[model samples]
Target: MKMSQTQAPFARLLDAPVTLGDERGRIRILYEQGNVVLKRSSSVQGVFRGLHRQAAPSLQEKIIRVLSGRIYDFVTDPDDSDGVIWYREITPETDWVHINARYAHGFYALTDVEFEYFCDGRYDEAAEESYNVADTLRDALNLGAIQLSAKDSAGIPMSRPVRRAGDN
Candidate 1:
C-alpha cells in the first residue's frame, strides 16, 4: 500500500531488503583512516524512517546537501575502482557495529559513513520515501539541529545526532 506524505517514515523491520543493485556506487566520505564501508541492512530503514517522524517540506534536499560535502568519492570512480572503489553491496564480514550518535542510534560502518536498509526488496517503495528522510538528514547535519512543529514531532524522538562514524 502507498503511504501518505503525512505518514511516518519506513518501518524498523527485522528482515529489511537491501542491496547495491546492479549499478555501481561510491562511498563519498573519509572519516578515520582510508576507505570506510557501511553495511545497509539497517541504515536505510533508520535514516529514511527517522525522517518521516517530522513534518518538513525540504527534507530530501537537506540530506543531499549534508551528504554532498562529506561524500568524497564514489564506488564507480577509476583509481579506487581497480582496488576497491565500488559502492555495491557485498556480504557483511560481521554483524553491524552500533554507533551511538547523540540522535538516532543504529548500526554503522566502521571505516565508512554509509549503511544499508534491508527493506524486503521493496526499494522502489523505499526510494519514493527517501526524499523526506534524506532531507531530514541534511537538516540534521547542516542546521546541527532540526526544529519540527509539535504536530510534526508526533512519533519522532528527541535524539541529538543519529549515527557517528569512527568516533571513539
Candidate 2:
C-alpha cells in the first residue's frame, strides 16, 4: 500500500484496502494489529472535534477511518517551529489517516458522519490536552459556525504554553 504524506511531518494518508467478493457481499480488513483500543464516534454536520492529544507517558498513535459521510481532518505538531497544520477532506472512499502520538488531531464534520479509530495506547483522561480549534485553525480554513463540546470549547489557545507531564 502506498502512503501519502500530508503537510504535517508526523502524519500520513493511507489507502484503505479494496474489498473482495461479489454482489452477495463484500469484506475488507480495516486493521490487523493487537494490543490497541478501537473506538467509534458519530457526529452531525457542523460539529468540530479536537486538536487533542494524550500527553507524554500516555501518548497515543491513532489510525482513523471514515465509515460514512465526510470530514475535514487536520493534524499539527505544537512543538514544530514551522507551525504547519496539515488538512485533508476525507470520505469513505478508501482513505485512512495515520497520526503520530506527538501531533494533535481534529476534524470538522462536513456531513453527518461515523468514524472508527485504532489507538495504540489506552486513554488517560488526566493526560488529555487540547488546543482551541477556532483559535488555531479557524483562519486557515473556512469553517463557520461550528458546534463544540463543552470541553473542546474550553481548550487552551495555541499561543498558550502546553503543560508537559512534569510541569509543576
Candidate 3:
C-alpha cells in the first residue's frame, strides 16, 4: 500500500526482501538504473496442466493487490499458454512490490491437476475457493498479520529498504 521511488544498487535492493521478512516467500527483486521491482512469485507456480481443489490467485489480482491504491484495468497475456490475466495499474511510482498470492498459496494448497483444470476453464467452483484462500493469505502477509520471522513476534513492519554494505 506504500509507494516510493528510489535510486540504489542491486545487491542493496536484494537485502531488502530478506530484511522485510520474505525469506519463505521466495521473493525475487529486479532492478534497473532507475527503478526497483520486488517480485514474490516463483516461475514454477505459473504453469498449469491440470486442476485440483486448490487454485492460485489469478495473475491480475496479484498486481492489483500488491500495487494498491492505483487504478488497474484488465489485460491479458495472449502469448501465455493459459492466456494469463494481467492488470495495468496506472501509477507513477517507480518502486513496486509484486506478490503472486495465488502462486504462493497454490504452491502449498493446490495440486497440478487442479491447476490445469482451472486453466482449462472447467472448474469455476474450485477456482473461486482457491482464490479466496489465496486472497486471505496475501492479505495477511501484506498486512503483517503473518510473521515471517520468529525473532520478530510483531511481524515485519513496512519500512524503507535499509542500506547495506556495497550500497551507494
Candidate lDDT (C-alpha), each: 0.25, 0.73, 0.26
What 10-residue stretch in candidate 3 is worst by lDDT? 109-118
Each prediction's TM-score against the native? 0.20, 0.71, 0.19
User: Which one wins by TM-score: 1 or 2?
Assistant: 2
> What is the per-residue lDDT of model 3 for residues 117-165, given as tens digits with 9 covering 90 to 100?
0121222343432211222333433322222223222322222211111
For candidate 1, the lDDT comes to 0.25
Expressed as tens digits, the lDDT of each residue in 4-99 for candidate 2 is 799999998866744443322233434433556666677788778888999999999999989999988877788786666667778898466789
TM-score of 3: 0.19
Error of 2 at 51 (Å): 0.8
For model 1, the stretches where C-alpha displacement exceeds 4 angstroms are 1-111, 125-127, 131-168
Runs with alpha carbons beyond 4 Å of true place in candidate 2: 1-34, 159-168
lDDT for model 2 comes to 0.73
Ranking by TM-score: 2, 1, 3
Q: Root-mean-square deviation of each candidate, in angstroms? A: 18.3, 13.3, 19.2
Off by over 4 Å in 3: 1-23, 42-147, 156-168
lDDT of 1 by residue, 1-168 (tens): 222343446642223223332112222221111222223322221222232211122112111112211221111111122332111122234242222111122111212234442111111223222112233344444423333323334532332233323312
